[model samples]
Target chain A: MILKSAEAKPHIVVIGAGAIGSFYGAILKRAGCAVSVVLRSDYETVKASGFRFTSPLGDLSWTPDHVYQPGETPLQTPDYVLLCVKVLPGVDRAELVRSWLGNHTALVLIENGLDIERELADAFPDNPLLSCLAFIAVSRTGPGTVNHQAYGQLVMGNFPKGFDQHCEQLANLFREGGIDVNGTDAVVGERWRKCVWNTSFNPLSVLANGADTLTMLDAPGGEALIRLMMKEVIAVAEADGYPMPPDIIEKNISGTRAMGAYKNSMALDYLNDRPIELEAIVGNIVAIADRLDVPVPHLRTVLVTLRIRQGVDSAHSE
Target chain B: MILKSAEAKPHIVVIGAGAIGSFYGAILKRAGCAVSVVLRSDYETVKASGFRFTSPLGDLSWTPDHVYQPGETPLQTPDYVLLCVKVLPGVDRAELVRSWLGNHTALVLIENGLDIERELADAFPDNPLLSCLAFIAVSRTGPGTVNHQAYGQLVMGNFPKGFDQHCEQLANLFREGGIDVNGTDAVVGERWRKCVWNTSFNPLSVLANGADTLTMLDAPGGEALIRLMMKEVIAVAEADGYPMPPDIIEKNISGTRAMGAYKNSMALDYLNDRPIELEAIVGNIVAIADRLDVPVPHLRTVLVTLRIRQGVDSAHSE
Candidate 1:
């Protein structure tokens, strides 16, 4: 479904005002869009001082045109609703943004993992559902504070395929705000590319008990295990009709090696006793593999370990 | 070399008097053998009050005929030296028992893991070396106390091949002491059989953060992961010419399920921050698989996770 562009200065609503949501919303606002933010944990702080972002794309302080606490409706209809929450289990994402979604408001999910757009697409049949992948190193350091370590390019497309007029307009707005954006027709394939790295490093970091990228790669038999897991992912992808480039595994390994001692976010989540996106990141791939009858023993083993740990962790908390 | 039976009462010396050593030494003494134990940490307490055993075989308290500290030589040359220490990476097992071995003494290793007899075989070229596997559930509750939960069967054979008269002599001694004994010529195959269980549960328990058998088996994808790892072990064993029985994996799973909530030894070692037997158990299997050109991606993946965790854990302690 190709979506048409809205008026010149469109109103943008940010559903989750965390790192990715806050960063991209501020970028759109810099292009003269009227931005409103919805926040819970950092509502008071953001309402008081707004957000301070430190990024290579140019540091800036962004105060939303309007701020609304969760469960409160915005006064103006939004042109776009950016969903940037972590894709964790037990969160009904479609219901989270139902109140703010207007008739023409295109839902853009600038998040991780695959098949994340299905629920929202099912909920709002007429709305343009844009699935996005944010290739950026950003984290929320403190209340209303964001730190962008590296890269800030976004790849986005319509629900299942094709770039539309609205996607082009959004890209132009991001370019005007000094951030690079790519409108791709094959954004789902791009997700598989990203998963080549995510599936190997994310759970491995936690399993290593909070090891960094290099620590995982440098340990005995670490590189081989990572390669085996990456091959499993590739097999699943290929069997699902998205064969990756021959050099993708090598590129991911060398790329992670260059990142030095960066701890993947899932490891940080596990260390901080927070819920992780185990289901979205690795579980879906294994599920697909099971359907395809493509054996993915390596990924399945790691997935089970993460599941047990997550289960036991939540059980203890309860 | 075949070993003839000793005089009416054989002189047996036990080294590394932890759980296995203590239990077996007490049993030998019950059969009227003159047993002497070498102690380290529990020397004073054991010398003062001896050991107390609680087992289905029978409950009894027995003091050793002689108790010598480490580095002290017993007055009489032992007919058999029992080595029951943990097969960790460091603390050379051969060197630890070097001072206790004599010209006529046979070294019996009642330990867990594979390829564990090679070092002792090299160290004592002329002396008899018997490799034995203890299928028992026992733990040292206190300095000089042991709690045996179930099963006290010993599988023994001469190292690297055929059983000799000493195997028969030792089996008779164990039988007289009210313990079950199986003296097989195919002990290496038996080691592989034991590994079908150890390679899966031991490392997996630690990976689950000290979870017991039921917790591991009950979690989603847990049993499948265990089965995958067990299959890999079987593959390696078959490639190396010791194919397991068809029902080995099922037998192991059901046996563990009936054990209630049992934490494996490696998991307990991890919980207590002691060194694990990762090398002797899973590492050697992977090494053999590598040499045999048999792919064991599941075992290799789990092996690297355990290695990194063990390495990171030791580093943090240092």
Candidate 2:
């Protein structure tokens, strides 16, 4: 399943030109792959200015070779589609993917949380879908500009199945673009591992108002509490039959402390008064816990607190 | 015990001329009580402008009989001293109370949290130390003015033993001054119960940035998280032999929601960027949990998050 040099570049379509999608598309374009970005009304700004990426590796700016709008532009049915939109409520996001998905098209999900892929899989059982865990601190600082605060490799693989040649070929395409891509057979485990970190830290940072480092270090009983919450997450993950390694939890905790001044995306949303990804993050965790019949008191507590903060009642009628 | 009205009213010294002290002093003055104020140098404006209370009960403005600094005042122990200063870290606040505590003196501890009374009880074992829970949402709108948001009653009682005559007498005095007073024998329970409310709502409000009602209602899973945290607090309280009723927790939640646009004290502290009362509220809860060998996973998580937020470590070092 390992891809070598000189393979035919796949035509990749990145949905939603956010930080993650822009990062991926711009890099793929530099790797000699034909990249198409589907954008909104702001497409002209991005096309004219291109995407400015400031990373530790170096800085680069590039405009995608092709652009498309959902209804206006007729899509060519890309060889691969990267779903990069933030999870907005009531949006039939799966249908949007279906528009660009073809028989040979492989869908890679780069969004936060674990359940989106499962939902997509259920909706399109025959579609070849891969789940990816991104470990980078990326944000859109301005129009057509993304600031890469931190850099880590992307861990991705085919879900529920072993890695195939297509997955490796895509991984190779990412690697050629200077992305540290790890093609794992245990994509679910990796996603759950990432979830452990997200569920424990993201809302906490948001609730504490961009004080992730303090939450990790100085909060009264903070370290102990995070450990307990993560322990619950690990338990839930194990009960769900995709047990993440103990070291994964430890690594996340340590990595969070090491992150020091990095504010989580949830905190950013709260600051900007944007609707949070509460359903995908906290709500999904509770749903999974209910499904697995595991007691997740701490996670449930955080979830409820976040839900109330977001003004959604128990009925979630909003 | 109820106090029989006497021809000569007893002299009261309000130590700490902050918002609460000023409100009480102004009310007592209007009620024909002889009151003096001990305040910091920064509170000179209160002396110049007298004191004003704009409350739902009624608005009043009056200058106290005298305003004295700590060292400038003649040292004559009064019948009662209302200790109203914030709990500054490392300061032996209880010892500061000792200077004003005479054999017959009654001291009311009004700061947020529980253990301060315990510390005072250890110091002044003989004197009548009344622990009070103030429910009025009084904020110092100006130097000598307080804007009372709501008119909730104050609960007060003596320590260790059941309510004595002195507790009732103070309750009567407050009642005479148009303050709703609930004199109870279960002062300890009252304090712990108030702690439960403060611990749950205050930090959440501060973290969410003055949106307690919305955050508690709208934030995904916020209510559940708050309920879980309350359960943890109740468990710790029970283990410490101060079990709060579930109804009280429910009332606190409903009361907070009812407060609507009002901001909690923690939110005020955060807005002012002042040092938070983390130790008094969240810290004491964690400490008591450890002491009683009860698990408070949710409280611990939030406490840690807030601690990092306040830069408590650096504050401690300073």
Candidate 3:
């Protein structure tokens, strides 16, 4: 059902108030969608003084029309719940968001990492499930403040079918909000393409111990390593029948190089003494490669050290 | 040809009085050989108080017969010049001890890493380079003080031919000092065997940013990575016609596991801001593998990052 105007505007409940969640939710709200973001520690501060969005284009300040925790919101069932929480290990994501998941509420995961949809899909199969790959350069510099540094493109697709009417409607909502959304049936391919950069550089940035991207690229064999790792990712993706572009390696490298002196999310978390999203990022690649009998030696070697750094001795274990 | 009496005792000059040099030189002095150690910053304190040897068996303190700077040492041509300095990039190993090299002076290298003797042998062909792989656990905890930890075994073998009377004589000299030194006809084999541990754990320890052995091993996939890297080393060694034992993997693992908790030399140097030995330890293995057309991907992967950490983009160059 293509809802239009006033009553037709779908309400989106942003599940996590981090950078992506806040920025996107604010954008959606500004674009006439009923956007409600769950405010945690900054509930009072953000609720009272509102929040700030510092982007290249301009700055915006607005109080959210609806602000409440899960189950505290006045709406019985939000049209959609956009999850932006980090898919790290030991997070009982299903349980944490149980209160917000109404019977028919569609769940859109605007998160990073691979193979993340299975659990939630299994738990709430009836509700529509969408996997979103965020290609935005955004950061939560301070409490309730999001700094949109660079890109803000989001690629999404509905589960199993990859694309459906719901996916189109959601993509339309995002496009109207000025998000530059891309709807694709090849969600897996899109993810693998993004992983080309994430797998190559995220943990490496962590290993660099908060060294920015430029400094990391400055390391001898470092830039070449990025290309090699990206090529490796491409190989695995091709093996899994989700082939990406021939020049994907160059494209990813140039893209990251253009990011210019940015510290990746993994490095930022590492520097702040918080756990990075290990399972969703590198571990899934290793797992999938093992399942396919593909030799991913470079990924294995780097992942082993990365796991050790994260104090995780074993990966993909229950 | 082993001399027994003091009148026929061979004079030895020990260069680089760090842990390995100080401990071994002191042991030679204790065994009645005329030993003169070239001192650096530790010169004055060691010269004033002599030196203290704190071994597991017992502690011994003694003043040296002669201690001086490298160029100021009295002996023009000592029987042996023990080189224990790190073979890192930019260090002129030959030129550092050019003044000590005499026509008949046998140069003994009690150091870590692989293929280290090739250059020195090329530089001074007639010096009879004796490569001693120190399996002993000893460290210079402070100036003029050495701590003898777990193992105290030295494997000495003559280069090129490996087995010679000089090797056996050096073994005997160490034996008289209560050191358990073994002479082998397989110097390359011994170095490769030690490289099993060094290549696997050394760079990793550095990458861990000075995390000690146990801490490193305790990390997830840490032990498995050690085995994998060791297997890769063995493959390269076997291809190069230096076939190590089939059970070398198990032996190396058990032996390192038995070391309990100790930081490898690379980690120690990294923590102290001193340059870690990259060329000799990892770079040599990589070079030999490349020469032999053997793929040692794991070692290559680790070495690339390790080189960056050591501030070396490349090795063995001006």
Output the number of the DockQ-best candidate: 1
Model 2 residue-pair collision total: 27
Off by over 4 Å in 2: A1-8, A54-60, A147-152, A212-215, A254-261, A264-276, A312-318, B1-7, B88-91, B149-152, B218-220, B243-265, B268-276, B312-318
Q: A184-219, model 1: which lDDT tens digit per residue?
A: 898888888889889988988888888888878889
Native contacts retained, all candidates in order: 0.66, 0.55, 0.36
Q: How well does candidate 1 reproduce the true complex, by DockQ?
A: 0.65
Docking class of 2: acceptable
lDDT of 1 by residue, B239-278 (tens): 9899898999989999989868888888888888777899
Ranking by lDDT: 1, 3, 2
Clashes of each: 0, 27, 1
Candidate 1's C-alpha runs over 4 A off are A1-8, A54-59, B1-7, B52-59
Q: lDDT per prediction?
A: 0.87, 0.74, 0.78
Model 1 residue A16 distance off true place after TM-score fit, in angstroms: 1.9
* TM-score versus the correct structure, for each prediction: 0.93, 0.87, 0.92
What lDDT, from 0 to 1, does candidate 3 have?
Answer: 0.78
lDDT of 3 at A48: 74
* Candidate number that wins on DockQ, 1 or 3: 1
